[model samples]
Target: MFKKPIQKYTGKIGEVEIGTGEKAVKLGGESVLPFYSFDGNTGNTPKIGMEISDVYPEGWTNTLKELYKDVSNDTVKWAQFVEKKYSPDFICLRLVSADPNGKDSSPEDCAEKVKAVVEAIKTPLLVAGTGNHEKDAKLFEKIAQAAEGHNVLLMSAVEDNYKTVAAAGVLAYNNKVVAESSVDINLAKQINILINQLGIGNENVVDNVGCSAGGYGYEYVISTLDRVKLAALTQNDKTLQIPIISPVSSETWKSKESVEPEEEAPEWGNQEDRGISMEVAAAAGVLASGSNAIILRHPKSVEVMRSFISELLG
Candidate 1:
């Protein structure tokens, strides 16, 4: 009789639990390649988060606005609505208006939004900054202080700001940190190492090893994901074994393919459908590649990915 080869790993993706109690969402803890359950443990099933902004988003398409019209005006209301209606595993609040280059909002206001959203829902909450290294470090500090004891997941502690973010957010307030890096295995591993050097445990880290979901470089993302997963499982790379989470919606929606008007690209077909398709496709690609979780903007995209994940993991 012919039998299949069963390969197992010495290391497992460190599991991270967000929020608390029964409603908490767990990610990672896989002992084998994603979905290779026949060989070893798949750990916790991948999670999906619905992404909303701290303020009403300005450039969102009409399709998305219409779907979230009732609650999009208020950040807390938006999260509550999604949690109740769609039942996502978590909610991601992008501090869009906090950018000093843009709205120049204060960290205090942003933290208030975080407190409001966290209070409004039982599901876990994740917060992302405006990518300003200095501002984000301060913003994360305030958010950590305000949300202390609630234990939210801060979107990132990048190479430039890992020290500040890790210190204030993780050490001071007991929140988790997302160690983000560009889509390269070495960079990914390095960031994890740096964050770990600060005494942050594997269980407290999630990796955002970049995403090419918006445009043309999916192969890079796939390769990075594959290498990171292989190292974690086969080579027992502890730093690389952390779970991955990518923000797919913001990436896809900002791309020209999704933003172009029909009149400008008459041959491209309907605009909204194109955007949704792109979002779903990009998210599915990353999930298959090895993302432990993905946050999406559109409800339709979330609905589709939920079913896709269920079908695949089933």
Candidate 2:
């Protein structure tokens, strides 16, 4: 007798909701691999976030600079502009000014800007700080306090400062935190364990297993994502079962192939097209590999990723 084999899983990525009211977005909750609807469930259709920074966005290519030219000077305006024009699944604000090595902007001031951005839009917001552990810990605490009732998503809580970030973001206030680790599966599982030990449930925790642009040592990123998702779906590892969000824009934009000038890299073709292609390709690669959500920079890249997701969902 020929019987179609249907695979069943004992574990599922927990679903966590960000923001409140009508526009709140949910990620995670897949009991199967990426788009493996035939086997079990592919859970949500994944998510795409438009990335905006607190700074003036200098050194950006002309297309992006012009897109937000009027709003580039103000973070609030930048948030509003993207929301009005594109309406991404969510808006992720990069608190670059808070880097101790950079402008070293005060946490208080950054929180004020965050509050204003929250007030200006109905869509949910994800607040991220400079990658420095010490600096980001302080920045996450302040922003978490400012966006308390809104229940926004904080960029991350690394091993160095998970206590500070998880305490303030999840305990003191009603928000979620990203357990970010370098591209290591063991580290990813360990960090999630440490965070859960803080008394935070899986529903309030997401994982950032790390990622890179497609050709730039990206094999590491893809492999880590695969291991984590497979463990969650097939092996049912609770610690690694949380949703994973990859910041594709942050990794792709800085690559030479995406940003080098036409005069310098004429063989590569148009710069904007080149960048968008890079962003879309990198994003598609991660999504296929098992990322629950992604962060994209250029609006065109966001549009392309969204269309690809739509086509896949259909």
Best by lDDT, which number?
2
TM-score of candidate 1 against the unseen true structure = 0.97
lDDT of 2 by residue, 1-314 (tens): 98888888888999999988998989988898888777877887799999898998876777778888898889988999899899998999998888898899999999999999998998889988889999888888898999989989998899999999999999999899999999999999999999999999999998889988876469999998899888888898989889889988888888888889899989999999998988898899889989989999898888888888888877
Scored by CA lDDT, what does every candidate get? Answer: 0.88, 0.89
**Model 2, residue 243: displacement in angstroms?**
0.7
TM-score of each: 0.97, 0.97
lDDT of 1 at 70: 86
- Quality of model 2 by C-alpha lDDT: 0.89
Clashes of 1: 0
Model 2 TM-score, all chains together:
0.97
lDDT of 1 by residue, 84-139 (tens): 88888988999999999889899999998898888878899999999888899989
Candidate 2, residue 277: lDDT: 89
